[model samples]
Target: MKKNPQQTIPFNWPHMTGKELFYIAEAHFNGRLAGDGPFTKRCHAWLEERTGCSKALLTHSCTAALEMAALLLDIQPGDEVIMPSYTFVSTANAFVLRGGVPVFVDIREDTLNLDERLIEAAITPRTRAIAPVHYAGVACEMDAIMAIAHRHELKVVEDAAQGVMSTYKGRALGSIGHFGAYSFHETKNVISGEGGALLVNDPASAARAEVIREKGTDRSRFFRGEVDKYTWQEVGSSFLPGELIAAFLWAQFEEADRVTRQRLVSWERYHALLEPFERNGVLRRPIVPEGCVHNGHMYYILLSKDFDRQHLLDEFKRNDISSVFHYVPLHSSPAGLRYGRTHGGALDVTDTQSAALVRLPLWVGLTHAQQDRVVEVVGSLTR
Candidate 1:
């Protein structure tokens, strides 16, 4: 009789701690079904404490948080926002929707983040901000990037969608920049089906941010009883996430450290098993810069220059294992090509890296036996 194939493993999935149902029930019982409610408050407090930000406002998605940042920075027509070419479309979409031009920059080969060294060259009189995405939960060179932003008088908005509770030199990834955006989408380490948060570092912008999140109304203050009534004050959009999502997110927060540790163990296991392949030039494992405490959100490998990453992806599927590729170099994407400027630099690293990288299965509930099967299949494909 033929042996049975192992169950199909997912790349990433929502890992519930058995606490979500309780929180959902609590939200239902409280009779507050809208944005500003007790569950939302709890989620906000959890994020503020974890990120050490002055305030945290939950939003419908990371895109909304980024759009809020764009609005707060006063991005307007003809203004330019510099960002990495190897990022999600939303990174540039937020600014582009505000009538600003997204100036694409190349990323460092090691971290796959915006090259801080190349930023100054991209700066111009029309430059308004620098949006650096912390790819794969590895923090970017924040100190260098921050210094450049300070001298150029440009706001820094961290697109930390993959970086939650991650740190660079002891400072939280999102807290280091003027503004930061985090995601709780199902694909991320934390999940609320779809939710995100905007971290406001500058104290002066807190009240305005609150208004912006509330669809340009002073409703947040009104609800706090600071004002008797609410009214629209400035140009803004509906960014606040509903209470049901926040309630689900709060359950994940309750098991924050435990979830992180579980993923870390799996990440380490992959690194150890794959180290020899990296040493022998068969593949390259992730490289976290010094002084960074990553959140174990992703584990990707770079295949040998001659090996086709896409071929391996097909083979993984053939073997009933699931692995995936990432960002398609935003500069080459149709929208980016049409609306964004490339700053006319060599994107050799960005172009090649995007094609060669592949992310393996990673999630809280992934078992060691399942991970071994994945590694075995990948190893066979490479050999």
Candidate 2:
């Protein structure tokens, strides 16, 4: 067998703006390899300026940020946090680590986000927060969700891990909630290898967020001359990434807009090329509601009930194209079963959508030729 002439396309490629090495070198020369150095401050400023967050504390990973949110909210044993079962493990694990019960909710068939309508019915006296994950960077119905939280006085944590440059009705995704988290993993629109940020929207939580990221100390305050000295003040952990990661991130931040634009170009091309398949009843394309601006974080398609999704994926493999499935509903996973319970009797929609959806290769710098190969392979397989 001979290798195909068509170039190999990966699911994701971390984009760079040509300044990463320069900044990393600068950080090393500045002699601050630890967290909260000059580069870290610049990254913090970028996040605050971009998202309008009152304060943004960079963390080692999105999981750490979510865990910090759980801690900041004072989630205690037996307390309940309502969230969709379709989300990642970290979404539930963060709360579960604090001994909080994850009351799982079903996701909307359209956006695959937590259904806002079902939230009120699922709330109980023990419910403390509502963690709404912005699936695929398209926001949940935040207006309705926010109203429900206001009525019940529950905290809202926006898991905007995939939504750095996305918005809903002119408001940034993470800025709408009390606490929001973003990821800069290699797979995300932004890349810091493995990094995340915790956005504190409430002004009151800004100081505490800083302390939490610095291992339960007021070191940040002391650095700012707000305190005479630093000491461990609360139960916390080392969540901040070293300055090297921040230095690399600063480069990405500089070109964040351009990176998002490039990804959007690829996303639109996929949507356009595949519309005929959608019209022919071969597949269904992603939907972006009006006023909701997504970051083109991913491009996925859904197959009809009669279609064998695995068969299509196998076809792509045979054609020398790479495609992959999305998440396995967390509620059905072992940890989810042990630490959580579902709001509805059966999460039928979640299970069905999970089975049908397949994510196509998408990333910045995906050439037209490569995209054409993907579109051609998909068209032939579906037709």
Candidate 3:
């Protein structure tokens, strides 16, 4: 009997910076495995220094971070928040959990981010905030979005889950909005298995943001000797991640630049090799506008009308290569239709992109041969 071939390629493989376990041991030996310990503080400092946010609070997950943002904004019943529909359920669910409505707008054709131009039209008297998801680590037109928010006197929460180590016009993605969230999930360029951070950019919300992460208490101030004793302050949750997760993340943070560079090498290789496919109109490639530096968080292509998106995904799976389709436009989902309402007009761009986008295997340390194999399988399927 012959053994079956293993799945040679994966959609994502978490990268280790060679110091994760050592730091984990250090964290354990340091006698604190809980949240807001030494390792956790280090992670917070790292984020604040890097992104220049007023405060960076580590969360158990990006979802939790978004929930914190929703709380910080005080989103109330009947309030509406404008955002793109082509995003993860968390983007809408966070606001919905607060009894706030999500106004789903269409995305841009090229970058697939929320159309900044359409954001204004979605605003109404009930609008409380604008949540712009930085899809694929490529930013939304934040300058325009910020201006609109200012004009409407609304808050801005950036869903920058894929925007870690990414920037827009010389500023960090998460640091631009009043609040921002980042995912350090195993699938992201950075990894702590399942971790995230909420960046409090607006100074006015800084103190309350801390209270919210500490389960509606002022424990952070107590720990820092800012107050004699802490008590219930506001609506909040237990959003802090454990010290071990931060320990693992600290090791990766030490090598973020190198890790990002390696991913870019793979991303560029895929873009170059797939050029012939793009030229032949076999597919459409990702669009990176000028001045917006993405973190190579993903490498995806849009299948042309001639190609079947599902067929390509199936072919990759059969060939021991892993590929995947991205989000299913939230507006079309059952929960979306019930809890959220579509704004601006038709969701043509969101609908088409959702059906066509297929993300290729992109991970740090992916060998050239493995990448070529992925390309070969895609080409074979397209042909």
lDDT of 1 by residue, 18-47 (tens): 989888888899887789789889988888
Give the 10-residue window scoring lowest on summed lDDT in candidate 1: 1-10
C-alpha lDDT score of every prediction, in listed order: 0.90, 0.91, 0.92
lDDT of 3 at 338: 94
- What 10-residue stretch in candidate 2 is worst by lDDT? 1-10
> What would the per-residue lDDT of candidate 3 be over residues 232-272, giving only the tens digit for each residue?
98788899999999999999999999999999999999999
Instruction: Write the number of the candidate with greater lDDT, choosing between 1 and 3.
Output: 3
Q: TM-score each candidate.
A: 0.97, 0.97, 0.97
State how far residue 101 of model 3 sits from its true place (Å). 0.5
TM-score, cand. 3 vs. native: 0.97
Clashes (backbone N, CA, C under 3 Å), per candidate, total 0, 0, 0
Better of 2 and 3 by lDDT: 3
Best by lDDT: 3
How accurate locally is residue 370 in candidate 2, as Cα lDDT from 0 to 100? 89
Model 2: residues >4 Å from true position, as ranges?
1-6
Question: Deviation in angstroms for 365 in model 3?
Answer: 1.1
